[model samples]
Target: MTQNQTHDPSGLSQEQAKVELLQLQAQLIAADQAYHQDDTPILSDADYDAAKRRYQALVTAFPRLQEIATQLDTVGAPVGSGFGKIQHVVPMLSLGNAFDDGDVADFDRSIRSYLGLDANQPLAYTAEPKIDGLSLSLRYEKGVLIQAATRGDGATGENVTANARTIADIPQQLQGAPEVLEVRGEVYMSHEDFAALNARYMERGGKTFANPRNAAAGSLRQLDAEITRERPLRFFAYSWGDLSAPLGNTQSEAIERLHELGFQTNPLTQSCASVAEMIAHYRHIEAQRATLGYDIDGVVYKVDALALQARLGFRSTTPRWAIAHKFPAELAWTHLEAIDIQVGRTGALSPVARLTPVTVGGVVVSNATLHNEDYIRGRDNKGEEIRDGKDIRVGDWVQIYRAGDVIPKVADVDLTKRTGEDVPFDFPETCPECGSPAVREEGDAVRRCTGGIICPAQAIEKLKHFVSRKAFDIEGLGAKQLEMFYGDPDLPIRTPVDIYTLEERDAGQLAKLKNRSGWGDQSAANLFAAITEKRNIALGRMIFALGIRHVGEVAAKDLALHFGSWDELAKALDLARPAALAHRSADMAEDQERAEANREGRRAKIKETREAVLSRLELHLAAREAWEDLVGIDGIGATVGLSLSDALANAQERAVFDDLVGHLNISAPAAPTQESPVAGLTVVFTGKLEKMTRDEAKARAEALGAKVSGSVSKKTDILVAGPGAGSKEKKAQDLGIRILDEDGWLAEIAPK
Candidate 1:
């Protein structure tokens, strides 16, 4: 703890210390992202802690790095944009780590000292294997699994309910559970299953994960739950986050009750009366780790009594009464041979590190992701210089780690070992597969191919997305089946429209599909029937299935509600294109003129702006209104608006969309609850719903022909007031909005 003998890694100067602090903060943040966000870790825990210590020492040594200290207050970075964020009722906390018996003793001693207990006093603990997998919090209400969230940061998480539902280990309904219960657990992939998955990916020339943990995390976070369903993911319930009522008197009793309530509880979890017993259990679990057929990085010891845990309380980022006794980190040194770019189905150009084969953590790793171009260019994702500003180059000696049995990632590059021949890997400006322009948009971390359907990868991915769980969801038409059919010269399922015509065409050159390999008469007929069943699909589903860039399920819903029908949505897209183009052209020209004028110190009016405006007179009222309406939607910003408009305007994209729409009947948006008196009325809900969640209330109102809006405006006809309703309730009263309690609102929608 003493810094009197501290040697300055940044040299002995305040300015150098400032630079060092920034580098440390950048390094720590990047490590958190690699470990938590990407499910891949480059640094060992000890090395990360050492860097933190050095950073803290520098900050203490210099008075100028206070801002860096402020940033340290935020434990992890913000949640990624790929999923919907959920604010936890009770913050999900991480556990402090203990690497040896000395740390364990200190942890036990600290707990006893906090409680003012004597040396001989027994401190009971529950010790269990810390599963090396994705942490999930499953909320159950009225015996039904309502929602599932991933532990993104300590305070917030990403919703993964759709993906969670696909796991067989997860219970859909609990018979003996409380009215409200949140069961926390780890979702993992068995070693056998992980191997099988990698084998399949290898066979298909698809992505093979670095380890089981990455595979589990990637599979669970998939946008399509069907992708998750096919992956062998399992859950082990070990803890609880939020609950309305108490399950038992103690932590051990609570876990037991969970077992009795049709939930899976860790069998190895046991109560240890003394620190010696806890250590013995920890050792036992450590010995069994390899034979468990799954990954476990550590053993966790927590206060067995719920009351004691509460009394002990928590730190900023971790619990005080629990500590994770982590095993030593696995690491190895390898040679970076090359950096290869691979295009994904979404056209994302991912950079992969081709490394000389190295044995790490009991596996030979030859490949790892460079993450993005920024990472390879000696900078973190935030543009902060990393690796001491030494960019990764070919023939570099790189240190790699297989943290938590997950992805092997480059930790550091040995610049001393680098030769003059070693050079920076240039990320491609064009797609290698399709030779299309690969563009990285402003504010985007990824570079994507712009070839659209002309790119084989994009077309296949789009087709897969079309039949995803939230889209068409044809029962027998899965990703594997689609992949097989798409590549076959005999079959015609290259596009969404082609899928509709499968039954009408011959199965193969050999014979009909029923007579071919892997296909029977019943199976072929079932595929046809399933496809037919989804002919009449929801409008929102149809929009989502189109796979328009920047359009997700929520966006699709917003568009559907705004348009009300497929015809209107199509017409809006069609009309909005030219208007958006004209606006963009004008905006760009004005920007260019201003820049040029600023540089030359002279003012000049752009003649092109007027020309674009004159050219767009043919836009008509529909085109103008379409562009306005698209941008006016609550969540649809100008960027997404432009993307949608451009997608609709593209010749190939429009052709594919047109063909798909021709074979389908998109059901009209359900009319506002005509039976209820509040039908077609704008409704605002405030505070917490006791009988149901906010999402459920909104859905119920929307189903009854009510338009649910977040704020209480002049347009709001009804306001559902729940307990703790504050600003919105006052606004409703000010606007003379009809406000009703939870019971009163339910009564209105109730049958007479």
Candidate 2:
């Protein structure tokens, strides 16, 4: 770790070090194919950089390490058999990164200061998000793409023409007829696709991807271009490497031209009139970045005027006219005032750390998730929760981090900051919200409250779930509005049904509720009206509204489509319950027999018998006939059915559901559309798309007749592969389904 004498760990002598450096250079040249040129990262950035740095250092320390030029200075031809190699007309280079906003601002100031321009000069700048993905240089001759190469080094890159052509957004031919052009952009994965892919990977007993950038790299570099075509890879042009003539005089104009030429550009990109405006734009993007569909490491600011850019050109590793204003990695240190327990809908207790308000990644943070009780308390010598050492006691300082720049999580606690007065924290034995005894399941971490429907927190969460976008989608009946409706002293609306019958309530009480100081009658009426409009919910939305565990929007839709009708689904579920009960009875009978056979005498048998009795009593109360029937539904998985049945069958939950259903209709389904492109056949889309956005394509296909499934299955009839399609395409190919490119897909659905 120290500043060393011969820091090389390989322990090669000077002569040997020179040969090793040359070998490393060659290896690195080839490794670029696996990294940038391909989707698979042969090594992590840190590992790759360390090797490159070591080689560079060796070459500097002993000049003999600089061996023969291995054509590393020139962009290598594409290696994959499916794609033909095309030499880059101009060199593609990588930009040096500035870690913080200060560094970027300094770069900007230096550029301006070097030019010796007065403050009065009309200095315009264009800012765009810096996508963390492979950098590609796309060249077009007579408006059509002739080549595509990676930014291997400053001078050259590996040819990836066939792979690049698979990217939907990347134009095969430019519009507006530019004679010669070379555009630079990043290829990336959407957050949704990344999450889906990782989920599939985990489900299939495969390793999860660390990040989307790694996922994109791995997808792009596959030996099969078909695999690359399936990944949800996207491209956004930022700059240019070669041009016969300028597309426009200004940087903004060039971007506009690119957009017009069928290339997807970042919508957030803006042309600012001043440095202050540029900084404002940068901060705006940083603040809203968490909700952005794709990953962006930072904002890149470029001098808008092409003439000025030309005059202020070329640094060793960056353009003098442009600088990236990087957002600091989100971090926060807050006092862990208390850790509260939250019982999930499925009876899992989650530990949440209450914290002093702190700003991180432009959002105010006052709470952090502790994940589990074990995570809250530090581990002991046996790697268990420390009994002697301090647990996450009241008033402890904790470091919180947003991994991949989302979700506030407690990273670590500062034990040193703990006061001696702080006592060892004990998790709550009962639910704080409903005073029910907390129960911990075997092989589970947190203890859950047995309160079920009576819990106020649970009720609130359920309400929020009911009105969620994928459920009822009552626009005005948002969380805040729901809270207002429930908490108002003037109005006694307490259940989901209460929302539908808001207008029918006493006028004086309603007026008092609506005109209660902050919110007006108009807003209250709007909320009620919105809730009323969603009374006839679709089967899928109704299923989601029930707030079943692990039943997300996609799963809900899948169930709805498969079951077709709620009546049929309900009947199926009802029939399945007795079977489940019989199964449970068998389990209980087996347990009794086992206890009788393997008793450590009568005392052990007595204890086991008592526990079994208690368990049966709980199950009898928890799993009613209605609940069993619901769980039996064919499309409803055990996890979801059990949770739903348990919630609804609970006396208090039943009362709430009954009251809500009485006041409003919760069973509306949309009419099926006319015949369309994918009717009666399952389809799964993967990778970066060109012809239409994922949502658009899904909607269009659904409207036409396609049943879009998330995962690849034997039922799938077609696989529309785009650039970076990744695994799904590979799975589809293995399954022998028909494959279609963006154009092919367009042709299939085109008017006859």
Candidate 3:
């Protein structure tokens, strides 16, 4: 179950495979949190993708494991706390990745199989460059730009409407657009612009970004609209989300439609008739990648026909109809000069390698992630040998690899070139920042500092995350400014509450903020105004701002929606605290029992422990009810539930939470729309859909306010049955539910 352990399910027992699956899930979650939430990736894209492939392979080998492997169903990290949340009507899912031609062929074969098409069938696909930048969704109402959001956790996104309006490539008005259209695309910066921007930053003594993708993302997420406007950012429309009406009958036609509507569509987008053609187009795009000016990690191939795409539908996190054929990772050899342990917001001790500058894929790589102590020691989580058991050390020549704009990572160590003086790195057992003990918990890959708020590094990182674009984004208070303020004795803003009382506190200070370095009266006033503006914030934003472990924007929003108010949420958490604790104890006991059973070849003990835990849990009816209420909300699982309850249960944390909430007005979450004919109704689709794909039907129904279910239950209001309708259809009939044919279903959802 170690982070780097990759085992064939065939070589392991079912219990062992299950344990490994769980470990992979945890690792992937951490990876997603780092890459998407913190904008700091612990693993390279190539490594992360490989881990996912390994995870999928295990699930495929042990089919029953799929039931518990829920992490694969998620996309992106939770939305950060700062910006307004935009619920994506149609979730912006990710694409499956194909690292090689064989994978690409497999992708095509899978699509064909799902659609019941043979290899000789002339199924067409459109291949376009997958831009290595931030994903954006532009919502247009009445052919005019209404809002813009970043892909935050797929289900919901951060509102960047003002910043988006500043980009010239994004059209403010689309003449031929539908009444409601969500144009999805990439917000990117060209190589020239990125270089120029970095040069400008260097001239101004500001920190320069590492690559165009990072530059584009940082620019787009700016708190100040003017800052975003100043950045040379561009957008390319390639897809649609939440469309009121169809853009076109096919994928290529839809891109043309987007182009006609004044958005910049990729000129290299081409429709191919076969897998060979798709591969050829991928190669063509790969060849033109460097000359494209913008960053593109791969070429995306999507089913050309819109109807077929609908039929292909989507996996939990990725689309079934599309795949990204990733370009091979570029590698270069460099000397490892030093190893540095950096403490993150969550107290994780992350090891980074200082490398001799070398060019990889045209970008100079000076540093790479070591991942953890185990990776440094050339061992996987299971103590298995990796990198031929060649441990990395200072002065060692290491092979570093970079894929697209992903952060560089050490691939292997060249021990043959190692100097006599080179020695294995001695990872610290104490927090280098605060001298606190750094502990690595059981089953954890990385050690963490127990310094809590006392650790300056952890404190500063948490503060930065608090004021970050996704969190309580106060203009004029960026990471750089916050770091400066954190160390300032006169104006120390170490906590969230301090940010709120700054203006009042500054009024009485000997030297006011306006008189300080890099500040003026207007700028200080603007900062105050920004802080005040966020005083009255959304419930989800407030929850996310608390920085509770495992409580990201999405989880916060789900809790907000279920509780409707802070008081209710607090009360529920209080009641569920004991139950959550009990459940955690039970889970730990079950894990121990399972492990013991696996070792002793006894399964009875595991079942007995589970049943005992279940019985004990039932004894506390009120607590169990409250816990169920919290976890019953979709996406709120045991991990998040435990974290939420524990955060509230802790006296110190509760004091901090209370102090912070006292300064803000938290609004209730927005309720779902209920005006449509099928609003509030549960719907199920069965059999082989003809007029449209089952996914398309479900999307349409949900858009019209219906809850789409995979199964026909007693609560099912309607069943849309197709030609091959079987068990679900029969169940609906047995339940006496209303049944509609494909045509009838379409008619039922048609505009009044």
List TM-scores for all candidates, in order.
0.54, 0.46, 0.67
Local distance difference test values of all predictions, in order: 0.73, 0.63, 0.77
Clashes of each: 3, 32, 5
In candidate 2, which residue ranges exceed 4 Å CA deviation?
Answer: 1-334, 342-349, 356-366, 379-390, 488-490, 514-525, 582-636, 648-752
Task: Please provide, for model 2 over 353-471, each residue's C-alpha lDDT reduced to its tens digit, 9 standing for 90 to 100.
Answer: 78898876434567665555555566422345432334577787877764222235655567888778988778777888788888865434547787665676766667776775446
lDDT of 3 by residue, 1-752 (tens): 21122222455445445545555554566676576557776554434554565566566566655534544445555666668899999998776666667777878888766666678888999999988788999999999899999877779999999999999999888787799999999999999999999999999999998778768877888889999999999999999998889989999999999998899999999999988998998888888877989888888899999998887776656778887777777779988888988887667787788988998875677877777888789876678877888888988898887654235677777767966987779999999999999998766676889888789998887787677555676777876688888888888888888898888888745235446567766777788899999898889778876777666665666577557788899998898887888887787897787787889976546664655886866647777777766765545667778878887887877887788889998898754564578876777788888766555576677667666655565557888898989887887788799999988988887778
Q: Write the per-residue lDDT of candidate 1 for residues 605-686, one digit (tens) a residue.
A: 5656746763655677667766766765544656567877887777877887888788988887676535777676767788
The best candidate by lDDT is 3
Q: Rank the candidates by lDDT, best first.
A: 3, 1, 2
**What value does the lDDT take at residue 366 in candidate 3?**
80
Candidate 1 steric clashes: 3
